[model samples]
Target: METKLTPGGIVWKIFKIIIYSLMVFFSITFVGIFVWVLINSFKTAPDFMQNALGLPEIKWDYQNYFDIFKFEYKNNNLFQMLGNTLIMIAINVICTISFPVMAGYVFGRMEFKGRAKFEAFLYVLMTIPVIGGASAQLKFLSALHLYDSYLGIFILSSGAFGSGMLILTSLFRGLPSAYAEAAYMDGAGEFTVFFKIYYPQAIPLLSINVITSIIAVWNDYMTAYIFLPTHPTIALGLQQLQRTADVHGSDYPLMFAGIILTMLPVFIVFSFIAKNIFNSKDIGALK
Candidate 1:
């Protein structure tokens, strides 16, 4: 049945159409990019150039996967590169999760004379780019004889010196104070109150932070490039592959394979934690 549309109804219908159009545009763009990457990961250079926008005519080439682990154009071994990348990411994730949880709790719940000033200091520090401090960090590491070592990379990555702490602090503050107060009234120590009460309430936010930090460190190239240039991680290895493409020219399939491999662990981890990220009630109150 056709009903007469008022001016307001017509405007509303137009607005809905605009919104739907935008949504469809973005969705198609995202899917197209993803499919392109997936297809390119299996195609040789010639095939890719010929059928850049088409589906794979042949089965997905497993040779790309094999080459990522075994092929060597430069001195770097792909297996070692993968290991180093995993190790760096692990160290970063561990430090990012553990330190921020404790620091956030302290900043959020604990009382101190210079607490406001301390938080202000962190906020200010976050403004300074990591690259800006690289030279100083190198000098300090050189002084301690930690240069070119895994420990050096770990320390540099772990320094929870940014928005992570602040985000956790806000989440902690949003938590109910009644639990801590009750624990305190029951003669529980500060440590006990934090561990037994507040910490539990912060798991969801903590998981979100961990996932973000993991992805950042995993996908990072610049810091790893500058700090451990000789020691090639997966990101660095991918960069090397791209750089040497003139000599090995048009190895898009292998390069894409390396990228997919690099992203696999992060995808797996995110899939596990994604549910928690979307549902705050499972972890604790952010509001």
Candidate 2:
């Protein structure tokens, strides 16, 4: 059975083809660049400049990677910086996840006076784009004596509101009240009911948020630059490397190697999650 394509269907097919072609083209471009960088990472500076985009014809210098392990910024080595970044991510995840879960339950389930107004206020706060606010924030932090310390960064990042609150609000609001009521009837307190029942239900959303926060924190250098200047993370170290390269001549191949090393962790993590992103269970709907 041969069916002729209508004009509208033909146009739609052309549109789809164009979109697919662009995606493939960009993917190839990205992969090509990545391969070029990786190839250069193993070459000597002279070799890299000689054949920037080609395979390493000179000695396959693996010493570049070893040099990165030895690299230091502000007395913090790569390992120490990695540890700091992990700590930052851990603190953020704990704060962000725990606070939102509680807030979501309270705002979504418990009806109190001015509850709607409070929720509205949170929304309003989210809408206000914070540009710097550095002076007031510094003053406040100085008042508390938390400036330039791990605790200060922890306190700042561990806020219990904003985007996470909104996301989890919808999830908790849609949850059935029957289970909570049953738990209450069984002499369970609010905390117990929340921990035992509601918390388990929101694990999927929480897990995804944790993964996202890890990646964001891993890539973030600006916050660390401001708050944790003494303890530079991988991203911050990369920035320091760039500065050093500019002022003092750097081994270009070694710099490329360092760049790739810093990128690999986040790249691996995102790749792992991206594959299973859609394969996971349907989110928001509780078991």
Candidate 3:
């Protein structure tokens, strides 16, 4: 059976088709670029630029992977650089997750003098631009003999005292006090209630916040550049590579290899947590 469409309906349908086509085109283009990079990562310098947009012209040069780690200057291996990046990321994740959870719990549950003042302080801290604080933080770390150290960068990145507090405070505020009250009546102390009741309920929000913090820290370059000057992270290292290439011609294959390596961990982590991060479960409903 054939159904006839009105002229207006036909026009509308055509518009919808065009819109969808554009969306698909853009999506494919984005994926294609990454695919190109991934494939070219396995190519030699000559073949990479010559046939970058085409399929691999020869056997996948697995040596590209080996060469990346092997091509070292000044006795620094790429593997060590990757380890440093992972260490920084790990520190950021720990501080972002733990500090925010406890601070959020306090802001949400505890009643004490200067509570409002402390909350206000957090808000003020959030308003201070990160760039402005970098110099002063570096100096403070220097005074404390923490300059050019992993601990210094960890402390700077992990100072999750502001945005994390805000996000968790909102989540905590939305939680029902009835649960805590009941726990209190049941002979549960403050710590007991927080650990046994509140912590369990906050997991979903915590997961989301942790994922967010991970993405931020992973992509961050300025802080890594300024504070971790001696210890270059993936972001800083990539920037340095780009600068080097600009000065001394391009090495497309090596560049693409570096990019693919840089993005692989983030892709894996997000793929694992994508389901939970996007889950629609209500944190407040957790009993």
- Whole-model Cα lDDT per candidate? 0.78, 0.82, 0.76
Candidate 1 on 1-287: residue-level lDDT in tens? 99999999999999999999999999999877766787788886678767877776565677788877875533669877777777887887788768878888889878899999988887777777657677899998899988878899888766654566676787787788887788788999988988888887777677677787778877888877877766777777777787776576778778878777777788898898787777755344322
TM-score of 1: 0.82
Task: Please state the error at residue 124 of candidate 3 in Å.
Answer: 4.7
For residues 61-166, what per-residue lDDT tens digits would candidate 2 score against the true structure? Answer: 8989998788899999989999988888888888867887888889877899999998888888878998978777777788998887778887787777766666
Ranking by lDDT: 2, 1, 3
Q: Model 3: per-residue lDDT, tens digit, 1-287?
A: 98899999999999999999999999999998899789888887777767867767876776766666764433446776777777877887788778878988888778899999988887787777766666788789999999889888777766656655766777787788898898788899988988888888878777776776677777777776777677776777777767766776757677778788878888887887788766745434432
Clashing pairs in 2: none
| CA lDDT for candidate 2 | 0.82
RMSD (Cα, Å) for all candidates, in order, is 3.7, 2.8, 4.3
Model 2 has a clash total of 0
Superposed by TM-score, candidate 2 places the C-alpha of residue 281 at a distance from the truth, in angstroms, of 9.1
For model 3, what is the alpha-carbon lDDT of residue 52?
69
* TM-score of candidate 2 on Cα atoms, chains taken together: 0.91
Which model is ahead, 1 or 2, in terms of TM-score? 2
Clashing pairs in 1: none
